[model samples]
Target: MSGTALQQVELVVRTIAQTAVDNEKYFGDLDAVVGDGDFGYSLARGFEKVLEGWDDIDRTDVGAFLKKIGMIVTSRIGGTSGPIWGTAFMKAGISAGPANELSGEQVVAMLRAATDGIKARGQSDVGDKTLLDALVPMTDAIERELASGADHAAVLAVAATTARTAAEATSELVARRGRASYTGERSRGSVDAGAMGVAVIVERISHAWTTEGAS
Candidate 1:
């Protein structure tokens, strides 16, 4: 079970990295609507570092692997992207502790930890028109699905859809955080790039899970 869990984690993380790298231009375009247009580039660079050091990351446990990735991201990436994303991973790692196996509840706990960390690091929350707007609702959907006895596949599916809907809804919100917030009311009518990035990454993870993680 622990070995399978590790494999699943690796698959999910790898998918996230690939999605960030592949959609760099799309993400940048989204951010350019009201931001400095560096969100995608910054994210890609951080995840690229994760991929580059994948083989070298300490896998003593899930916590170590996630924490190591967090450190790499924090150190390698620049601007706001580094701190926001890195804090998420680090907090999740803290919740995961030294466990090699993660139960469904543990996964939720890790996600909550990550979300809280992001809120703290960015000083934002749901309705802030930040990634938290999408992330919070997606996490809620995931928790509800899991509580109903859904499996990973079901949770991933729900989360992906929820994230997309939530991200798209951000177009109606005025940005309250990040560089987009600097534009004030002008930030309306544009989706939050980080939220959309989460949607894309979760969608890819869901697809990858269905195709390659049924074991």
Candidate 2:
């Protein structure tokens, strides 16, 4: 039952798409508490397009699929999330290229590119109470795991745990950037909406990748 990397990527896409759809209301609710209530809907629409365009996406190579997905997200989705997320995926796609299969090192490289891209686009650091709060540490953990010669699943596991921890830690920090910044003290004790979404995607993708590798 072992699936290829492409299969893993596809499963991740589908799982993220499903999660975005199911939790759209939750994100909107979170956003409404502090910022604009658009993150959930915007993410849902972006991932929905990814799912609906799967037929065309399936025919493309991995890098091409990722690139197309990024473009689709940027063009179809609204709000700051669209550009930031699109930049992350596009950077990953560039790093991944059109390889038929990716080594663990390549996976690590892609993750690093994604993190750097998010930082570059958002100009925020790990404590910004944004998605970077999850992504930055996760990518660092992933690189460390891979450098230790861990398997892809192992690296992903480390990344997932790091992301979850970072996402949770966002609750304690004041929002230093984005719409949440205006809330100041009010933003404390609540997870950033975008960071929560990143955690969800990271956890799901880690589970899928590990299960696929084991199978």
Candidate 3:
């Protein structure tokens, strides 16, 4: 891979951080309906810490950098959101496996690992109206696009769209996990905050990569 392509990992991190900052309040509002209303704040603080410690991370190794992100998030953010997001990043890092750069296939693998990690950590499934509602669909879309010989940018775009659609659909389902589950039928009309967060991150990632690739 070219040096330019390798730098895309850094771009992904920056994009996610910015997305978290921009949508923090939105996430909080979503959670306030069915959860503790701190989901957005926790995500924002965690990503901000990732940015703050960016200089200390081993940027040359994408896996190590992602692992650092997971560690930082776990340390900075309190509550269940911290461990869930941290586990996702850490599992993605493990899938990345010390690579300095990632291919389209590797990116898919990383996303799958992250989704699996969230499922394991939260003990939630796709119909549970958790982040997996968005993440699993996004990952599946990426895998399909890649299998069809789409490039990284194309795959990411499809995945982002899928995540958004899945997130929107969450409003129709009753929560089966997380604090939202405590609300039972009351949670049916509201979208999952974590799912919305996943949608935002994937959308930002798609936009960032597409813009960078074009440039």
Candidate 4:
């Protein structure tokens, strides 16, 4: 937590890429339930590129690094996952601007910007039975915890819990966006793969924050 914002962002992005790579099959299996089954594949491939080119990534600032990642995800990844996730990093990068460090409120703002980009790119919202179902709630939880003056570690833990709970709850909701929506009421019994993926990724992020030295 004493390092520059660049260090924090690097840790998070690396954790996310590793998580996606590690859970490729699991994520694909989850997506196969109602989706075209490419969610995991697309995500893993994209993040893999991120890791593969880690040393080449821009390190001038957090914004530049994130924007570079956004470009890679959008161009390298396939399927809907590419554009949506790409837009998130792009928006977050723009929101972050040229900062070397970000406060808790600034972090929340960056997340909000990313989510907003996701909503626009995917044409979806919180109740759409998409990743937004988990992402929005997790962001909200972080905002609330920050308002209460929680530390970074505590905020991450709360965010992980909130994402998992929201993702699981999506099982009870009918899909309203993406390929899953075509399933109609039948999608109710299964959780949104994207949402659950978010939960899983967030959980890994939370764990890494505690044990990874965060530098």
Candidate 5:
């Protein structure tokens, strides 16, 4: 039997939490090169809170669950990442509404809404060496592949690859926003830590949904 929508969301959350925990040191090392090095700890702490409160999350409504995640992260995490990531999740949740299940189109819309929320919160655009560098491209890839009638696994594969590539490419660009921007040309040659984190999260979430959890 297929997984329920609540189960799918739980899988995604678990994947994200695990990814953050697994890559904590790596993300901190990345941030040390271009910005303050607290990103890893902050993200991990926030996701840890989400895990601790998982049982309390309202599973009947996917949107409510996602919004609860946003609030948990925002309240627990520190720095700009808290607000940015929180806003992204909140916006996606809003786009999801109260639906028990989401279609591919609804998923795409959620991604788009999340991307827009990030932009609005960060005031940054693509190629700015921020998370948007990876997220925007991933969203676009998902939209394109879904439009082409790709299956869930196929679309997620393409999206994950695109996000990874985009994150890697940030090493070639100068930072235009955030603490990294203060480094000017020195920010080049170092991948944006936030972008890499976003890539990891997206890839894991996609894998969880397409493989272990739901369509």
Candidate 6:
């Protein structure tokens, strides 16, 4: 898949929701390992609403669809992750606007926007062992690949790898934000559930584009 290739927003939404659904228990357990067990359930509730609105979303209009998903998720899910992830989506949607086909630059811009939104909403950074940890590396990889003129497949490949690496790196650091932060140094040796979840989302997006033959 080339970065120049087109992808439908509906497909992306479906993939994200499905991934969260499949990993519901996993997320709960991860959070339960260190903090509240509601993260997964809250995320699932939000994604369920997004799934319901899937068919109605404007597939070709990336921005509108993303914005709608963000709003739906934020309203349905009752937790911190909901608003944070939703804001990220909303920011990405605003950045991409109504583009029917996204170029590499557009994709990079969306990722950057999403990261910024998450930061503003969460007040967390990479070393804090939050979603930003995964996202920062993923976006940097995407930007590097985009600058080198890599195709969608290549860009996505780098993103998945970088996200995974960042997610793993979270375990070595003590939590500095959110519920887990309350645990202080006890948060060490535990992977950040939010970081893992974000990694899954990014990896799945990459998989969807490649499997669907976006190139």
Deviation from native of the Cα of residue 163 in model 4, angstroms: 0.4
RMSD of each predicted structure: 1.4, 2.1, 1.8, 0.9, 1.7, 2.1
State every prediction's TM-score relative to the real structure. Answer: 0.97, 0.90, 0.93, 0.98, 0.94, 0.92
Give lDDT tens digits, candidate 4, residues 27-131: 999989988899989999999999999999999999999999999999988988899999999999999999998998899999999999999999999898999
Instruction: Give the alpha-carbon lDDT of every model.
Output: 0.89, 0.81, 0.85, 0.92, 0.86, 0.83
Q: In model 3, which residue pairs have backbone atoms overlapping below 3 Å? A: none
lDDT of 6 at 26: 92
Task: Rate residue 52 of model 6 by lDDT.
Answer: 74
lDDT per residue (tens digit) for residues 1-215 in model 2: 15777777667667777788778999889777778789899988888888788777743667887777788888778888889889887888888888768887887788788878888888987888898888778878877887898776777778788888888888898898888899888989989988888788778788776565564
How far residue 73's Cα lies from its native spot in candidate 3, in Å, is 1.0
Which candidate ranks first by lDDT, i.e. highest?
A: 4
Relative to the true structure, candidate 4 reaches a TM of 0.98
Candidate 2: deviation at residue 159, Å? Answer: 2.3
Best by TM-score: 4
- The parts of candidate 3 lying over 4 Å away from their true place are 1-6
Better-scoring candidate (lDDT), 3 or 4: 4
Error of 3 at 82 (Å): 0.6
| Colliding residue pairs in candidate 5 | none
Which one wins by TM-score: 3 or 6? 3
Query: On residues 1-215, what C-alpha lDDT tens digit does candidate 3 reach at each position?
Result: 12443377778777888898789899999999989899889888888888777777876678877887888877888799889889888899889977875777898899889988988899888899999999888888988998899877788889889999999999999999998899999999889998888888889888777666554
The lDDT-based order of candidates, best leading, equals 4, 1, 5, 3, 6, 2
Model 3 Cα shift for residue 175 (angstroms): 0.9
What is candidate 5's lDDT per residue for 51-93, written digit by digit as tens? Answer: 8887888765889888888888888999998899898889988
lDDT of 6 by residue, 1-215 (tens): 33432255565667889889888999899899788989899988888877776677655567877888788888888878889989988999999897878767887888899999999899887799788988898889889988998776788888898998899889999999999999989999989998899888878988887787544
